[model samples]
Every structure is written in C-alpha cells, then in structure tokens.
Target: MDLSWLIPIVMTAGGVVALIALVAVLARNLKKVPPNKVLVFYGRKHTTEPRHDADGKVIEAGGTKGFQVVTGGSKWKWPILEDCQEMDMASFQMKPQLKKIPNKDGVLVNVDAVASCKIKSEQSSLSAAVERFLGKTTQEIHAMVLEILEGQLRAVIGTMTVEQLIQDRETLNTRVKAEAMSELEKLGVGIDILNIQSINDDQGYIEALGKKRTAEVVRDAAIGKAEAEAETKKRSTTAAKDADVLAANNQAMTFEADKDRDVKKATYDALIKAEQARAEQAGPMAKAEAEQKVVVQQVKVDEERERANIEVQKQKALVAAQAEEAKTVVPARKAAEALVATAEGAKKKLVIDAEGNRDAAVATAEGEQKKLVIESEGNRDAAINAATAEQKKRVLESEGARDAEINAATAQGQKLELEGKGKAASIRVIAEAEVYQAREVGKAQADAIEAKLLAEAKGILAKAEAYAKMDQRGALQLILEKLPSILEQLPAIVEAAAKPMSAIDKVVMIGSDPNAPAKFAGNVPVFLAQLFETTKNLGFDLSGALKKLGIDATAISGPDAPKVD
Candidate 1:
C-alpha cells in the first residue's frame, strides 16, 4: 500500500516540474523587439515573400528565406529551427577628425566635424544593417560611422581650396554627406546630420588669407570714400549752376510774360478806343444822313408848293379871261340883236362892231394865259436847281468824313503792328538767352553724371572680378546657405513691388479670361522662378541646390507659370 502512494506522488511531482520548465523555455524564445532596436530571427528560411495579383488575390503563399526581421513588435522563435537576435537601432553621435588632409590647392588642412548616424529603418537597409551590426555595441557603431565619414570628409576637403574650405564649409558638408551616404548604405548606416565644426591649416594659410582680405576691403573702402567725395563735389557744383540757370530762366520768363501782358493790354485799349470812335462817328453820321434826308424832303415840298402856286395862278387867269369873254361877247351879241330888230341898215354896222369887240376879248384872254404859263415854268426851274445844289453839298461833306475815318483807322492799325513787332523781337531775344543758359547747364550736369557713372563702373568691375574667381558650386552653396533668409524676404519683396497695386482704387479688367486676378496673383510663383533664374545667371544655381534636397525644380517652375509682368 505505501509503495503505490509513493509512485503516484512522484509522477505528479515530475509532471509539474516538466510543465514549469516548458513555460520557462517558451517565455525565453518569445522575443519582443525594443522600440530602438530590430529583432532578427534566423536559421530555417524561405525562398520568397507572399505574392499577390493585381486584384490582391493570393497567387502564392510565399515564405521568407535566410533570415526574418522584426522592428518594434513581438515574435515567437521556432524552438529548434530559428534563433532570435536584437540589433541596436539607436543613433550615435560622432566627431570625425582628419589630420593634415592635402587639399586641391596643395595645402594640408585639418578638418573637424560632428555627425549623427543610425541604422536605417528600411527593410533592405535593415537587413544589410542586421548582417554587419548584429550584436554590436553603440561604441562600435559610433566608431564604424566615424571611420566612414572621416574618409569621405578627407576626400571632399582634398577637392576644395583653402579659401573655399574657410568660406564655404556648407559645400564641404554637403559633398561629404553625398559621398559618405553611398559607402554607408552598404552597412545600412544613414547620416542624420553632418556639420563641419572647425577647419585650420598647419601652414598659417588661413591667417594670411584673412589679412589679405582685410587689406583689400580697407583699400576698397578708401577708394569708395574718395570717389564719393569727388562725386559729391561735382554734384554740388552742378546743382548750383542748375539752380542759377533755372532762376535766370524763371526771371526771363516772368519778364517776357509781363511784357506780353502789357502789350496785350495796350492792344486791347487801342481796339476799344477804335470801336468807341467808330460808335461815336456812327451816331453823328446817322444824324447827318437824317438831316440830309430832311433837306431833300423840304426841297420836294418847296417844289410841290411852287407847282401849286403856279397852277392856282393859271386857274385864276383862266377864270378872269372867261368872265371877260362872257361880259364882252354877251353884250355885243345883245346889241347886234337889238340893231337887227330896229333897222336893217343900222344892223350891219352894229353886227360888225360886236364881232370886233368879241375878237379883242378872245385875244386878251390868250395873252393872260400865255403870261401865266411862262411864270410857272420859271418858278419850277428855280426850285429844281436849289434841290440839286443842296444834294451835291451833302454828298461832298459825307465823302470828306468817310475819307477822314479811313485814314484814322489805317493809322491805328499801323501803330499796333509796329508795337507788336517790337514785342515779338524782345520775346525772341529773351527765349534765345534762356535756351543758351539751359544748354550750358545741361551740358555741365551731363559731364558730372558721366564722371560719377564712370567711377561707379570701375568699382563694379572690381567687384565682378572678385566674384568671378569663386567656384560655381561654392557660390551656389553659399547662396543656398542664405536661401532660407532670402526666401523669407521674397514675400516682402514681392509685396513691396506689388504695393503700387494697393494705390489703384479700381481695376477694370478687359479680357475674356475670368481668372485674370487669379493669374495676376499667380505671378508670385512665377516671380520665384524668375528669382531662381536670376540666381542661375549669377553662377548660383538655386535649382541645383533645391534638387540636392530632393525637390523637383521643374514642378516648382511649371510650363504654365505666369509672367511677372
């Protein structure tokens, strides 16, 4: 009975221990990748990853071969088939120091730089990193990166001159990064940053360069100061002459204007006087014409009165002759009738007497009528002569007055013409004088400006010579270093250039395009292209710098970019 109980207890105890050991082994094999590390599981491998078609349908249940990698996750290793290892993904800082590296200028330079590198997180790069850096300490990783970078830095410095090394370290840094990245990629190492800390030469070349630059700058400053002073003196003298000439011109113009005003005033006064005299003459001439007309009418009335008197006298003479005829003829006829009735013999003598008396009366009446006709003819002739004489006198007086008026007008016109000629001659003389003064002043100013411009051109030529000596890449790198500040100021420059648009109160667009304003605003991007183009012209290719940073310059400067104008 005791033996049977012991066997069950022993078997139970053995089963529990085996279970605890299995749990311990399983826990140990289940590895979790650290946040800053990669866990690689190696041993039994597969040929390929899982494959898919266009529609994502599984074409093959592919498996990984050689080694499988995990970054920041947990994975259980096959107990007998696979083993797990952790690779440090943490970054390490490096200070690569190169001693007496010979540069392109044949000068030995020592360069010091700081850099940070880490194992790449990309699958291919991580696999490459896993092969070399597996189980490697952080110090070992730092040392490896330092060796790669220092070699690259040496090569980069050797390609540059002493002046470039001092003035353009950024170019050195960029080339080092570009060159080192190719070598480091083999070991799956990536450079986060590479900056040159210091550069110096054993031969004291940099100090000499600095001293030479300082002397050049001082010489340029002195020359600039002298040129500026000379220019200032020339400008002062020119300005004084210009001021004097302008004052003289102004005074001449004022005198001419005053003289013109006075001449015009006199001309106007003469015209007014002439018109007033004409007006005065017009009234008197009209009155004289009316008086002449009245005289003509009075002459007509006197002629009419004389004719009436002549007619009245003729009528009275006719009446008296008729009465006489009636008295003589009637009495004679009555006497003849009385004699014929008394006696035949006495009737003949009485008839003869009556006939004689009738004849005498008829003759007397004819004589009276003839005398009245002669008197009427004389009076009518006298009246006609008087009227003709008055008319002739009035016509002569009118002709004399007209001739006098014409002479006065001709005299006034000649006086005005002579005065105008004098004034014109005076104005011409003054204008000629002012023109001469202006030409002299302008010529002097031009001479001064030409001298100043020549001086400026000389200074610019000197600067251009200095800039021409710089390497294109080094200049570009310098520009790129300041590119951030330049970009920051671009908006301000563009806004300031467009400031005139703010002064416009209204814009009247006359085009078929509705996006005119948008296109106008889009010029800002085009201005960026123009700025880049201008930099390129100056041997600083900003586009090349942008391309190094993995930016597509073509995309930034598109084909449809608006023109700045």
Candidate 2:
C-alpha cells in the first residue's frame, strides 16, 4: 500500500548501475602499465607509419593507424575500441633440458640449464617487443629465451672441456651469455642470467679425470716428504756424534774430583779416634779420689754411734716396768664396759617389742572394717542387677507381643492380595476367551459371505453373457433363485434373536412412575431391529420379500414395541 517494495528495487537498480560503471572504469583503467612493465595497445592502431628518432632508429610517435608501445602511465581506452597487452620488464626464469651436447673432450653430456630475460625499456626495444613478444606472457617469453640460450650453451660447450665447464663456471656463463645476447636483443629481451646447473655423462669421464689428477698430486707429495726425511736423518747423525764427544770429556772431570774428596775423609776419621782415647784415661783417676774421702768420714761416724747406744738401754728399762703395770689394769676395765653394753641392749629390745604389739592390733581392726564395707557394696550391686534384668524381661515380652501382631497383619494382607490376584486372573481369562471366540466367528462368517458373493457374481456374469447371446430368460432365472434363498434367511435371523430369551437372568424395573410403560424383555426388540438392518448389507433389497411375507418391519424399529429377549 505504501509502495515500499519500490524502494529496494530503485536502490538495487542504482547500486547495480554504479557497480557496472565501476567495473567498466576498472577494466579500462586496469590497462595502465606500471614502471616495471611495458603495455602495448594497438587495437585502434594509433600509429600508421614507421617513424625514426635522432639516432635514425625507427621510433614510434604513435599518431597513425599502427601499434604503439607505452612504458608507464594510464591510457584511456574506450570499450571495444582498443585492446592492450603487457610485457614484463622484470626478470623471468626458464629452465631447459640440454642433452647430448658435445664438449671439447669429445664426450656427450646431459646438461640442465636456466635462463632469465626481460624486455628492454628503450623506445626501439619496446617497439621491437610490441612487434614481437607484445602479447606473450612472462613464461612464453622465458621459453623463447631459454631456447636461444640452450643453443648458445651447446655451442659454448663444444669449445670448452668438461673440466673447464665444472671448475670455471663463470667463464662458461660469459660465453653462453655472449652467444645468446644479440639474438635475445633482436627479440626485444635482455639476458639477465644464464646458468648451467649441472652436467653429467653416462661414462663418468669427469669423475675419472678428477681422480687421475688427484692421484698424480698425491704421488708428488709423497715423493717430496720422502726426500725431506732423508735430509733430516743426515743432520741428526752428525749432531749425535758431537754429543758423544762432549759426554766423554765430562766423565773425565768427574773422576778427578772423586779422588781428592776421599783423601780428606780418611784424615778426618784418624783425628777423631785419638781425642776419644785421652778422655777415657781421665775417668778412673777421679773415681779413686772419691773413695779415699769416703773412708775418713766413716771413722768419725762410729765414735758417735757408741754414745747413742748407752742412752737407749736406760729408756728401755723404764718403759718395760710401765708396760707391766698397765697390762694388769686393762682386764677389769674391759669387763665393766661389757656389762654396761648388755643392759642398754635389753632396754632397746623392750621398746621394739611394745611398738610391734600396737601395730598388729591396729591392722586387725582395719581388716575387719574393710571386709564389712566390701560385703555391703556387693549386696547393693547384686540387687540393682536383678532389678534391671526383670525390667528387660518385661520389655522383651511386650516387644514379642507387638511383633506377633505385626506378623498376623502382614499374613492377612498377603492372603488378601493373593485372592485379589486370583479373581483378576479369572476375569482377564474370561474376557480374552470371549474376544477370541467372537473374532473366529466373524472370520468364518466373512469367508462364507465372500464365497457366496463370488459365486453370485460369476453366475450374473455367465447369464449376462448367455443373455446377450442366447436369450433374456436365462438372466431372469439367476435373479429368481437368489431372491427366494435370501428371503428364506430372514425368518431364521428373527428366530436367532428370540432364541436369547431363555438365557435371561433378571430384568429390573427402572422407571420414575410405577404406572409407566413396562420394559419387559427390553433388549430383544433392539436386537431384532439390528438383525433386520444387517440383512441390507447383502447384494439385494429385502423389502420385496419382507412385504410379500407380510412381516411388520416397522414394529421392530419403533420405541414402544414389545421387548423380547
């Protein structure tokens, strides 16, 4: 209603237009060549004639209908009016397989090589590239340059040996570049690098040459070392002879010094023994003088000893008399001391006996009192234990009664549960049997109906075929026979309904008023109506036969009809 759907449509249109214009601008402006690349644009042919510079080189002052080469800067080329192609001014690498190139040694070698090339930035070289490799990519230009360099490498290898190619690689590079230089410049590309990466031969000639030269060098070195060793040995022999002469002269000087030292040692030993014998003679003369002085001193000592002996005899007689007097008095003194000791011992014995008697009496009384206390405590503990046992006995009896009650209840519950399970099992079995019997009877009835329908359809088909060919009478006969058989089952169906009346148990009277209509044999009329409705399911109209038989089908349908079981 607001026309809001137009907003996105208009915006998308504008955005798409802007995006297309940007893409077009990009496509045109993308033709701009950088400083490192040369762009050749010639679809419009801005140049027509070959022009020249001051050096008489064919310069391209692009104004006529011809190709023009641009080195840098943007060019506004209209769409579908001009086209531009680029040539790389930077180096490009190309590897080439150079096989079976002969060398100066007449050996065939396999060589792998690489080439680097770029477009020359000058007007003439740029013009040449526009004329030649203008639409060529970097790889295409490199492949062309590689082909030229590969030919040049083969020519250079022919002039040089394999050893020169391996050892002096820089010289090989110079020759290869010089050979390829002019040809590449004509194609408007310069050679920045030309390298021979490897060279090999199936015969291993290069390896054999290197080994031969190395062996020659090794032989020369061994010869030089052997000559130097001989010269060194000659100088060593002369030096050893001079060393022997000097050693003999030093030995003669050592022998002369040894003889002079022995003479001085012998003279010094003789002087020491003469001095020892003179000191031994002085010892005995000193000992004899000491003994003569001791004999004079002993005579003076004997005179003093005789005077001292007479004084000692007088003192000994006085001491002997004093000893006789003291010995007689000492016996009576010992006897008195013995009698004093005996009386004191008797007093101590009496004191110990009294203390022993008192301690024994106290211990007997305490023992009797402790025995009475222990007996009373034991009696008290026994009474308490007995009381606790009686209370425990009463509690156990009560718990036993409660447990008996709980067991009785549990047994009663289990019995009730088992009885309920038995009743439920019986009910489930009866219901299952009823359902099985109903299903089996229904299946048998369906099979009989289906067989009868099939036979009737076949008869109708046959009669229709017979009527279409033979007559109309044949078709009418099958209809008459099917009609009478169907009418015959209607009376039997009615009897099957009334047959359940004999099996009824009780029919209760349920009504608001006792004077109201009765419901005796109530289910029979509903069963008869259902049985009548069931006859309509067969492929026939039961009303023709029912009306001819004069049965009141309406009386079985209404609500006030008499009920029969």
Candidate 3:
C-alpha cells in the first residue's frame, strides 16, 4: 500500500466518522437526565400557564397550552421555540443570618440559623412554580428562607419576654418550630429545621439583663422566704394565743365554779347552823314546858293542902270560942250565986252572969291568939313557894343568855374567816393581772426588736444588691476599705449625741490583716483619735470615744493593747 494515498482516504473517513460520533454523543448527553434534578421547557409563553394532563386534570410536566416539564433528564428541543430551565431536587443546605427587633424592650438580637430543604418528587411543578413566582436561583430561595425564618423568629421571640427567652429554652424552641412551620409552609418549600446556629445581643444589654434578673430572683426569693417564715410564726403565735385564751377561759370557769360552790357550801353551812340552833332552842323549850307542867301540878297540890289546913285552923278557933263562951256562962252563974246569997236566988244568978262575962273575955282573947298563929304559918309557906318559883325562872333566863352569847361569837369568827379568804382571792387576781401585763409587754418588745432587725437587714441587703449590680468587685472593695472609717466615726458620733458607747464595744473592721492583731489595733486607735478630734468642736468627748473603742487609759499606756483578731 502506498502510504500517502491511504492516508487521505483514511483521513476523510476518520473525519466523517468523528463528526457523526460527536453528534451522537451530544444527542445522547442531551437526552440523558441528572439525578434529583429537573428540566422545564416553555414554548414562546411569557405568561404563566396552567399545566394539565390529557384528561383535563392538572399535570406536573405539561401545561394547558404548550409548556412541558422534563424531570431528571435532558430533552432534545427546537431552539427557536423552546426555553429550558433546570430545577434541582437534591437536598440544599443554607445558613441565614437573621436580625430580630424586640418589642418594647429595645433588644436587638441577631440569630444565625440553618435550614435544609428538598424539592418533592411528587410535586415536580414546584420548580416551575418557583421560577414563575420567584427568581430561578438559590439566592432568592435563600433570601426567602432567611426572611421567613427571620420573621418567624421575630414573631416568636417578640411575644416572649427577654427573661423567658433566656430562661425557657424549650419554650423558645417550640415557639420557633411552630412559627417556622407556618411561615415555611407558605413558601412552597419542604424544610428541615437544623438549629439556631447562634444568638447574639449587645454585651451591655446582656449584662444589664443578667443583673436585673439576678436581682429580681434574689429579691423574690428573699421576700417569699420571709413571708413563709412570717406566716409560720404567725400561725404558731395564733395557735399559742388561742391555747392561752382557752386556758384562761377554763381557769375562769373553774374559778367561777369554785366561787359558786363556796357560796353554796356557805349557804348550806348556814342552814345547818340554823337547824342546830333551832334544835338547841327546841330542847330548851321542851324542858321549859316540862318544868312549867310540873310546877302547875305542884302548885295545885299545895293549894289543896293549904286550903285544908286553913279550914282546920278555923274549926279549932270555933271550938275555942265555944268553950270560952261556956266558961263565961259558968263564971256569970257563980257571980250570980254570990249575989243571990246576999239577995236570995236572983242575986245568985246575977253573980254567975258577971263571972261568965269575965270568962267570955278571956276565951275570946285565946281564940284571937289561935287565929293569929294560923295566919302567920300560912304567910310563911306562901313566901317559901314564891321564892322557889322565882329561883327556877332566874335559872332558865341565865341558860338562854349563855346560848345567845355562844351563837354571836361563832357568827363573828365565821365572818372574819370569810373576809380573809376574800382578801387572799383579791391578792391572787392582782398578781395574775400584773404577770399577764408583764408578759404582754415583753412580747411586744421582742416583736418590735425583731421587726427593727429585719428592717435593718433589708436595708443592708438593698444596698448590697445595688452595689453588686453596679460593680460587684469594686463595690465590695469600696465597702471593705470604708468599714474602718465608718467604725471609727461611730464612737465619736455617739459621744457627740450625748450617748454612752460602753454598750458598743464590738466594731467590725474590714481590709485589715486578720493574722496581724497589731496591724488593726494600731490603726484603729489612730483612726478613733482622728475621728474624736474632728468631732471635738461638736462637744464630743474624745476620752469617752476612745474608751468606747476599747482603748482605755490603761490600754493606751503600757504594752497591753486590744486584740482585734
């Protein structure tokens, strides 16, 4: 073979085949589809057209007029009439920087968030829809996602307080998720929320917020604790008071019952005494009645005997009168006889009559003597009976007087005893009242002191909070540095106010070396002296102030110094 002739033919054939293969490769490449991507073709249609299927249902690939969508492949088309675009269905990752303006709190927080999304395989029209509505670039989608995320974050964060945002992370996350869902759903994009990449706020504002929250939490905790303690104390106090009141009521009831019992007992005793007195009087009355009955019987018997004796005496006197009359007649007859001897029988009768007259005078005198003797005897007996009756009456009267005297003495002793018991009861009541008053006064004083101490502690706590929030270390250093000066001035102030400092010996010192006792002691006395000297014009007693600082004359003199460790 001639090499030159064969080379031309070969070259011509190779060029023809090469051109054909190149065209075939280009066509194949055009027909082949990329995975998770789509190509859309529009034919001379500037307006957005609805795509549908053959049955008049909306289609994902072909539009109603002349638009067609090719998914995951390249298609051959007429260059003059067809326009094509690529829509990626692959997962896309984006980080959007978002700025949120807080409402009413003047807080501007910047949020960096990431979003992942992918086109739905079932909704291939998404790319066309996106192309029509938004620019067919990742920048616009990224902007949309950022705007949506930003809006959602702001909407979520704006509804919450800074404290809630800072403290309640879960609530923030939930709220963000919800807001993002609502906003992203409207963007026609499937979204996978990754994370809030970062959040940033002004440093000063964050510090301020932290301080404010800390202060608020501390204050609230303190208030709640104090309230709980106060409530517990109040409940305990109320219970104690109720118990005391109940006890007092019981005591009063018991006292009243005792008083009533005592009164009843006294009444019963008085009744018993009265009954005894009545019994005693009844016995005396019965005895007196018996004596009276006996006396009546005896009197009756004496009366009968005396009457008989008087009758006998009267009969004897009558007999004596008769005998005397007969004697007188005989004497008269004798005298009459003597006279009749002189003048016969008639003269004798006259002499007898004269003798009888003389005898009658003598007999009458005897009868009169007997009558006088009987009368004397009767008078003596009557005198003796009357004397006996008078003696018995006197004895009964003496017995009645003795009983009356005894009763009076007994009543006087009982009255004295009752008065002593009443005096003792009055003394007890007064003592109890004084004790109660003292207890109440002590309790009131204790409560006042507790309140005062609590108020002082609150004031101190408020000052500490303000200082700590302002500049924590600086404020602490300032307080520590000024403590000594404050302590030194206190004694002078007290002395200037004409108050004694003997009770205020313990003073707190700060910024002084704790291990070196002399370091504090040496400076403290000088500070006290300076303070006292400054207030000397105000009539402050320097010596008294020094003494109050535990720097007496002896302490100032020798090696003995106050230890301040």
Candidate 4:
C-alpha cells in the first residue's frame, strides 16, 4: 500500500550513486607528468594531432593505434579506449666498469667511467622514448644505459692503445659518448655527460717506463757532475800554470830592468868623462892652432916665391917656343896639306875598286847558288828512288827471313819443350829431395828448440816460484849480493858508447861559446839523472836500492838530482 513512496526514494538514491561512479571513473583516467617524468597513453583511436618535423614538414597522424606523449604536463586517458604509462625523463648517473678489454695494441685494460643519461625530451625523441622505455623503473633504465655505455666504451678502447687511453681521457670520453649516443638514439635515450674516470693495466709497463725515465735523468745528472768537476780541475790547473808563468816573467823583467839601470849608469859616467877630457884639451888645442897658423903663413910665402920663379922660367920658354913655331910651322903645314890631298885621291880609287869587286862577287854567288839548288834537287830524287828500292828489297828479305825464323823457332821450341820437361822433372825430383831433407832437418831443429824452450820455461817457472816466495827484503839482499857482478858489466856501457867515438878520425868541438866544455860537463850529470830515472821506470827503484846499500843516491836519482830538460 506504501510502494509508490518507497519507489521515489530508491530512484533518488540510485541517481546519486550513479553520479559519484562517473566522477571516480573520470578522476582515474586523468594522469600528471612531473618535471622529471613523461606520460604516455597508448591504445586505439588516439586523439593526438600530427606534429611538424624540424624542417616544418607536416606528418599525417591521428585516428590510429598509436601512442600520445605528454612531458612535464597533464594528460587524460579515454578509459578502455587508451591506456597510460609513465617514463622517467630525469637524468641519472651511471658508473660503467669495463674490465680486461683489449686495446689497439692488444694490451688488456680496465676502464671506469661515470655517465648521466635520461630519456629524450624532444617531440620525436620523446615519442621514440615512450615507445621503448615506457613503464620502466629508474633503476632498470639506469642498468640499460650502463650496459650500452659499457659496450660503446669497449669499442672505443679497442680503437686506441693503452698509452692513448692514459694520456687522452677526454678523447676517450668523447668517442665513447658519441658511439653510445648513436646506439641509444634508436632506443630514444640521450647521454648528457660522459666522463672517463680512470684507465689502468695489470702489467707494470707504465711503472717500468717511469723508472727508465728516472734512470736516464740520473745518468744525465751524473755525467753533468763529472764534466763540471773535470772543467773545474782544468781551470784550476790552468790558473796555477798561469801564475807560475807570470811570476817567472816578472822575475825576468826585474833582471832586465836591473841590467838596463846599470847600462844607463855606465853610459852617463862615460859621457861625463869624455866631456871633461874635451874641456881640458880646449886651451892647448887653441895654442896649437895659433902656432899652426903661423907656420901656414910662412909656407904660403915660400910657395909665392917658387911660383914667381916658375913664372919667369915659363915666360922664357914661351919666347923660345914661339920662335921655333915661326921657323917650322909654315913648311909643316904645307907638307900636311900635300899628304891629305894624296890620301883623298887614294881613298876614291880604293872605293871604285871595292864596288867593282862587290859586283863580280854577287854575280858569282848567284851562279853558285843556282848550281847548288839544282844538284841538291837531283841528289834528293836519286836518294828517294834508292830508298824506295832498298825498302822493297828489305821487305822481301824480311818476309823470307821471318818465315825461316818462325819455322826454325817452332822446331827449336819443340826440342826445348822436351828438354825443359825432362829438366823440370829432374828439378822437381831434386826439389822434393831437398824439401824432404830440409823438412827432416827443420823438424829436428824444431824438436830441439821445443825441448830447449820447455826446459827454459820450467827453469823460469822455478825462478818465478822462488821469487814469489821471497820477501821484499830478501829480494833486495839478493840484488845486493849480485851487485858486484852487475858492476863488472858497467865497463861495457862505456865501451859500447866509446867504440863509436873511437872510430872517428878527430873530435871537432866547433862552437862559438867559450864555455862549451863546461856546458858539456854539466850535461853529463843531467844525463846520469835521466839514466837513473829510466832505470826506476823499469821497476828497479834504483835510488831506493842504492839507499839500502848506504850509497848517496841524491847525486843522481834523488830529489836534488838535475831534472832532464
């Protein structure tokens, strides 16, 4: 009876429940994409518009079984018509450790690197990333990225040597990132930062190389130190020698200065004495000049008297000569004129005769020259004809003689060859016999020499053994004991030198110095000192030996001895 009122109440409640159910369904379909995430809705009949590519080319899209992507924004799913998924777009760091990877040089190395990777955020990249990594956890994405990075890193390391890996880490990182990004791009993954942290090898080659470089540096330092020390010593020695030379030069210069001073002093004294002598002789010289002038005047008066007498005699002789000339000159002049005219006539006659003879001689010489030229031409022709004929005869004779001689020589050569062969055989036999005899004799001599050498070697060995056993003092005593015998041979030294000198006819000591004998005597001691020095150099220590014998070694071989020049 109350059914109508209950029906209205039930319908109102049913409507309210239906509204709440619809709101809940709408809320469940809505999704939010955080700044670090991307939302992807994929199902049938998507409502997303087509996107323009980087070149602004339009793509036909929508109304297809495809996915819609929303990055850092909100997106709604059309319940049952589409399903939604979220992809982490946030960057995460991954450490990729590649172990025992062989490089270009086939050296096994381990590489460790840190990389930051995320899903691509670009429209096309985001669509690609949503298709690949949609609904994946951050850890799972990190693992996938690490694997890709490690594979790319191994590929990069295989292209480089351990040295390049160690020295060029930046290049390693760049190449690894490039290769990794190329591969990850297909998976819609991007690499933001990639860094190679360390590269190492199990082998100790790098340590050894460092050690070798350090050793080389040490060697250079040692060589430099030695060279510097040698240079310093050389400079020191040079300075010492220079000081000695300078001191000697100073001493010599001092001697020269003393000598010059003495010479100047003597020269001044001599000049003063000469001036005093000149002063003392001046008055006497003046008086002697006055007396000499008086004598000169007297001599001049005597000369004038003699000159007057001579003038008188000359005047008398002149008068006599003038009279004689008057008596004889006219006739003599006439005779000379007659003789000159006759000589002139004879000269003309002789000149005419010479011309006639010259013409006759020239004509005769022309005839003789023509005759000689013709005779010479005839003789030359005859000689040429005879020479030609003789040459032909001689050639024929030489041909005949050559043929005969060749035949004879051939016959003689055969005979001589037979004889030479016989002689050679005989000679060979004789040489063989001689060689055998010589070999036997030489063998015998060699045997004897070998025996003698062996004996000598044994004796020498015995002597060496004995010497080795003796102390230094014992050896010196033995030397002292044999000193007299050694001295007995000393006369030979004098004789050896004097024998050559004795063969000379005379000794000519020709030197300008008066003290040559003294100098030669002085050189004898120097020579003796040099001789003793030579004996010491031969390991005898002659001065020490002499000192042990209580002899004064200083005279010849001690510190006081004269140095050899």
> Candidates' lDDT values, in order?
0.69, 0.60, 0.57, 0.66
**Candidate 1 on 367-476: residue-level lDDT in tens?**
65456556676665554454344434444444445444444544444455445445545554554555455555545555555556545555555545555566877677
Order of all candidates by TM-score, from best down to worst? 1, 4, 2, 3
Return model 4's CA RMSD, one decimal: 41.5
Q: What is the lDDT of residue 508 in candidate 4?
A: 41
Cα RMSD of all models vs. native, in order, equals 47.1, 71.0, 44.2, 41.5
Superposed by TM-score, candidate 1 places the C-alpha of residue 242 at a distance from the truth, in angstroms, of: 2.1
lDDT of 1 at 388: 40
lDDT of 4 by residue, 1-565 (tens): 6588888889999999999999998888878778987777778555656777789787435455477777777777888788877777778889998878999999888788898887777776787767667767777777887888888889989999767877788888888989999999888888889888877778966566667878998999999999999999999999999999999999888877765675465345434433443343344446655765565555555555545555554555455445544455444444545544554555455455545554554555555555655667777555545544554455455545554555555545555554545555565455455545545554555556555555655565565567668876776676677667656754664355235335658534443458756654554454446545544443344566668778766765336555422
lDDT of 2 by residue, 1-565 (tens): 6999999999999999999999988785666779887777766756455668799886656456466677788877666777777777887777778778789988998888787777777776777777877666666766677778788788888999888887898998888888888788888778777787888887888778778889988998898898888878977887787778777766665654554454344233322322232233234334543653453344334433433443343344345434533443343344444444444454445445544544554455445445655666676555445444543454455445544544554445455544545554555455445545555554555555555655655565564456457533443344456666545654654454444455657644333346423433343454444343433322222433455468666665555543222
Can you give the TM-score per candidate against the true fold? Answer: 0.42, 0.35, 0.30, 0.37
Better of 1 and 2 by TM-score: 1
**lDDT assessment of candidate 4:** 0.66
Candidate 1 lDDT: 0.69
- Compute the lDDT of residue 81 as modeled in candidate 4: 84
Ranking by lDDT: 1, 4, 2, 3
Ten contiguous residues minimizing lDDT sum, candidate 3: 556-565
Candidate 4 lDDT for residue 82: 85
Give lDDT: candidate 3, residue 241.
100
Off by over 4 Å in 2: 1-30, 45-65, 137-139, 227-565
Candidate closest to the true structure, highest lDDT:
1
